[model samples]
Target: MYLTQGLHRSLQRHPDKPALRHVGDGDVRTHTFAELLRDTGQHAAALQARGVKAGDRVALLAPNHDRLVRALLACWWLGAVACPLNVRWSAPELAYAVSDSEASLLVVDEALAGLVRELPLPVIDFEQLAQEAQGLQALPDVRAGGDTLAAILYTGGTTGRSKGVMLSHANFWTASMTRGAELNNAPDSVSLLVAPLFHVAGLGRLVGQTLVGGTCVTMAHFKPAAVLEAIERHGISDVVVVPTMLQSLLDDPGFAPERVRSLNRIAFGAAPMPPDLLERALQAWPHAEFFQAYGLTETAGAVCINLPDNHRDPAALAQGRLNSVGRAGLGAEIQIVDESGRELPAGQVGQIIVRGPMVTRGYWRLPEASAEALRGGWLHTGDAGRMDAQGYLYIVDRLKDMIISGGENIYCAEVESVLRTHPLVSQAAVIGRPDPHWGEVVHAVLVLADGATAEQLPLPVLRDWCHERLAGYKCPRGLSHVPALPLSAAGKVLKTVLRQQLAA
Candidate 1:
């Protein structure tokens, strides 16, 4: 049940198979399963030599690279917990994570080495470590128990400062196995890894692919042209992207039906895809199966996936089932519960809670936060959602994002969904602004389509558009145009950032 258990299986079953292919800055390098295993062993030995004993915390601050993957696997091999730091974080933020985790050593990419110079921990250059480990003997096997901590992944701090979500080997292994089974991952599958490995979804995809002996092609960073080129060149069969990345891919001039003809599946999550964008993607890559997954960092990865069949079925789209994040994944239990923690009935929106082996143990060193989040033995997802009689989970919006206007609760997602339907709108985000009379009023920030101006969608016109599709209170009272929305590393709209801008 250990995370590296599958890697050992892959080593024995497909030693010569291509395991990792890294594409960075026009350089392409690959490692066979055998090579990756050897590298993992060497990395483990190097870590041991550097005083990273079993149970030690090793922090990684690097972009996507083969060495980064090897470093993570090596940490698991040595029974050490790996803490992946977001590259987008500032030095102060990184300092907080490193100090909170009590990391003994930091492995940083050369590009980011400057950021960690002032940090107290001993630092190891990622490339230099690989060079040093080239001829080192393999470290002895040190297997970890299923419940042993494997990684401490920091949550994207949309609400506040980030907290480390401690995930055990069982948590990751369960998530990988469940996702692999549901997605029908196979040994021959070539998955393009475009998401940042610092995120759970990115790391989870790598683990899931490895569990089934699939080939993973890593991209240093996501660029629409580069992604399309990689797909065409490598004949990538599987890809996982967030809504923003999907939109960029569709908008890229290099994107075409022929470029991604080899794709067998495309899984999207982290945020809901606009209907217009999803429809465009479906048409452009008609041969590719589409899936939408739903999960938080605390769950390790996806616990619910909207299946390909549901995405392709026109009837399902008309019924709004396509908008759902799908049923509970294998071995996952999902429930909608009220504020008092009683389970809510189907068709009633409430908090979404999940219980499964895939869920994390708790946040690192944050007892109160952990207890509050994992209350009643379920991970309380602060999301407003409802389950249908047939078990489809429809996410309305984050409970925090709900706008309370004059005693009315307005879900921003509902308004954003309608706004996206307009041809002139490229992107839209709804937030609440202070109001003297209503307490809070709905405010819409929009990115117009190319060649379109803010004048094309004035407040009155946007108001009329929303009025046609929503109740009066739900319609945004104010409208503003932005060239782009602030996005998290996972390609989700950063509502916190939007709120700050509005406040200023």
Candidate 2:
């Protein structure tokens, strides 16, 4: 059940098959399963040479690259935990992660080598490691059991400084299998890797593809035109993207049905998909099946998935099922519970809790936080949601994102949904603003669509539009038009950033 088990199987079954096709700036490199295995073995030996051992931590700071994947596989092969630092993080932030994880070895891309100059760890340039490993003998296999720690993924620091999520080999294996079964990842599947590998969604997809001996086409970073070009050139069958990336692709001048005609499925998550955006995507890629995944870093990746059939069913859409994050994924259990931790009846919004093998063991070195989150034998996902009678889950919003104004509870998603329906609104994020009278009031920051302007859709007009579809109290009292909303690398709007700006 180790994460590297799939690679072992792929090597034995399809050694000469294409395993990776990496697209970088003016460069294209392909690797067969045999070649990937040989490189991974060399990398394992190299890590051993650098003094990394079982139970040790190895940190990586780089963008999506074949070398990064090899590094991860190499760590797992040696029974060491791989800590992938966000490439978008500042030097101080990266230092904090490496320090908190107690990583003994740091691997950085040649381009980012300067960022970790002051870090107190043995550093290995990614390219240099490859060069050094070229003539090294393959290390003997070191088998890690299912319970062995495989990775420590850090969460986005919205509440405070991010905590390290300790995931085991079992967690990664179960999550990949569960998602693969639900997504129907075939051995012939050719998946495009556009999401940052540091995120669970991207890394999990990479593992799933390897598990099935499928081809993975890696992109250095997400670019709408480059993505379209790769899909056309590689005939990529499966892709995972966030809603913001989907919207960007739709807006790109190179986007057309013909360019992605080979795509079989498009899986999306990391944020709620605006219905308008979903509708536009459906129109653009009519032949491709659409899926919406819902989970957290703690769950490895997706624990629930809205299938393509659910997306295309008119009755489901009319009944609001299309808005669902879908039913629980294979081998996962989902429940909505009241504040007292009792399971609630269907349609009642409560804290969404899950119990599954895919859930991470706990946060690294944060026992108090771990106990709080993993209490009562369930992973208490700090998200407010409801399950329909048939098991569809509708994510209301983050529990913290729920706004109380004039003693009425207002879910930001409801307001954002209404705001997005307006013809002029392209993107919208709603947050709670401090108010002495009401405790807090609803505020919206929006980006207007093409050919639209703030002058054309004034605050008064926007309020009226929201009023037509929402309760008077839920209508935003304050509106600000911006060209773009602050976002995390995973494509989620940084509501914390928005709140900070409002407070200042």
Candidate 3:
């Protein structure tokens, strides 16, 4: 299916239907299906006027807003690829992706006009671009389908320079259908799209809602109070968030059951979901259905999702279902394979490999790296995970995050999960601290619960606590306290930064 297929259908079925809404610092804006299509067409014409053609790359650097949405649709309309740059990046980081994507034109939000230094290409303000096209000729949908490049979404460079994952129209549609089917996106649904569009989780949610002709409300930035306000004000029925975002929303001073009572679906993923935080969310939104998605930028969106039924089922929870990212969704295949590509047995932790229609073709212009990653006809996800007898996938941790301490392998997520179970620990991140004798030692960085302090748990106390739940060798040998962990745009803990902190 094409990315904008539903938009055309909606234009025919219900032209006046509300399609998008944006709430930005007291500025509220909206667009109907007809309005959305017209805006998209005009934006497409604007790009065309600037010499953008089918198959050309258009770099989009903006936060979540109506103009950003229109620009994305405009690119798709002209069969051009949209490369959304991360707003959280430094000038160098943003320039790297822009240069790598070999973008022909830069479409930017005026607010971030100064971020791209030594601007290399012709730039058009997103607002002026759309406003200029108001009465211009409406561009026809080029109908770029399977294998046609749609968007170039760069991965969050938590480790190093980010790689742009090339996804097609079919890839987005596949992810939209797969994740939406599991999340149950209805036409009447009003999704609060607060996630940064640069990330797949946020962009995928936008695609899913648009594909179903559902309305999505955008927030320029993610703020818990604004999320509650949007849910209450716009009657938002669905939302997508990471574990950290979910916790903030549940703990936000403005949060109340009634304010978000309109929410019927909540989808979370992109990072580990702490059990304690998940439990708190469940209690706060007993009326909502919860979905846990698991995938990477290469996989478009979620390849697997722990469904609402399993989330709310007592028997399933007792059976440790909450720990699962769920079985592979339709059109996707999940496998745990050893280094040699041999499939591992159930419950054996190994590299998680995925194959599916939603899988990205490869990284932009990095054939050798692409071949290595997409080796054996499967995307070798760097994540270390295992599958149970029932095909439920349990994410352990990133393979690179695994620590070898005194010749013993220790997965950080295992240690972090146990640490989060501690009553006083609100958040935990584990890393390997270089030790002269042991080579590497498990080091724990923790964020304590409200009214708690580092004084409550010293290094020895933490080691003793971990020792009770973990093997002696796996127990942390070092401990530090942080008010909050540095995170990438997608909400994954920034271990590289943590390493720098340790060195300092």
Record all residue pairs in model 1 with backbone atoms less than 3 Å apart, i.e. clashing.
Answer: none
lDDT of 3 by residue, 192-295 (tens): 88888989989998898888888989999888898888889999998889888998898899999989999988999988888888888899999989988998
TM-score of 1: 0.98
**Poorest lDDT segment (10 consecutive residues) of candidate 1:** 177-186
User: What does candidate 1's lDDT look like per residue over 158-228, in tens digits?
Assistant: 78888999999899888887787777787899999889988999999988887778899999889999999
Q: What is the TM-score of each candidate against the true structure?
A: 0.98, 0.98, 0.98
* Candidate 1 structure lDDT: 0.90
Q: Candidate 2 — which residues are off by over 4 angstroms?
A: none
Model 2 lDDT tens row, 151-265: 9999988889999999898898899888877867889889998888889999889888887889999988888999989999989998999999999999999888998899979
Error of 2 at 87 (Å): 0.7
Against the reference, the lDDT scores of all candidates come to 0.90, 0.91, 0.89
Candidate 1: clashing residue pairs, number: 0
Off by over 4 Å in 3: none
- As a TM-score, model 3 comes out at 0.98
